[model samples]
Target: MSNVSYYTAEGLKKLRDELSQLKDVERPKASQAIADARDKGDLSENAEYDAAKEAQGLLEMRIAKLEETLAGARLIDESQLDTSKVLVHSTVKIKNQVNGMEMTYKLVAQSEADLKTGKISVDSPIGKGLLGKSVGDVAEIQVPNGIMKFDVLEISRD
Candidate 1:
């Protein structure tokens, strides 16, 4: 069975938009490129044709992957989210126990995780450690660098 991905309404819409673009625009462009290449020359000796075919294959693969992702996606209503504990779509404030540095991040799906936006995937080390934790709880997260401790300060839905 495929894993179910939880996403905010906006995130689900973004995925749908991307899928639509890939299907309506990119797929046709790839088909046109392949057709143009085919008109150029012999199949075995044509490098342009080979390149175009390869590009088409890559595009189809991406489309298939995106379709599968969209199929397994479940949208979460932001207004109905519980803020009492850390969960997907929850903005969590935490303090590094070792350095006393405070940081905030929103738990999001892998497709929507953007470091610049302070969103982390629930599959990430820190996000996994923070899941199900409430305020005042200390999470021990194992990152590539090392294990770090963070004290949960607040949890809210944004």
Candidate 2:
């Protein structure tokens, strides 16, 4: 059974575009490289040919993995998302209990997580600890440094 990956509409579209590019552009380029290398010299001891073949293999493997991920992906409807508790796509405001510093983050899919933009992956340690938590709830998350506590102040969909 394939585990379904929840993605936003934009994320799914991005995946599709990437797959198309890989199949149309990269795949053909790899094949052409192999063909050119093979034409250059003898097959038995041609390092260039071997390297081209290896690169093609790696490219095909990447294409296959992307296809598999797309097969199990499902687009999440933003309008249907619940805002009462922390969940994927929810922008949550939290306060560090130890330092009283407040920060906001949007829990998103792994593909869309960008820390510089305050988007965090749902599978991340802090995100996992915040999932399903409500306002006034304190979430304890184990990090590389040590355990940290966060107080959930608000949950909103943006």
The whole-model lDDT of each prediction reads 0.92, 0.91
| Model 2 Cα lDDT, one tens digit per residue, 1-158 | 66677888888998899999999999999999999998998999999899999999999998998888888898888899878899888999999999999999999888778999999999999999999999999999999999999999999986
Q: How accurate is candidate 1 locally (lDDT)?
A: 0.92
TM, every model: 0.96, 0.93
Model 2 clash pairs are: none
Off by over 4 Å in 1: none
lDDT of 2 at 28: 96
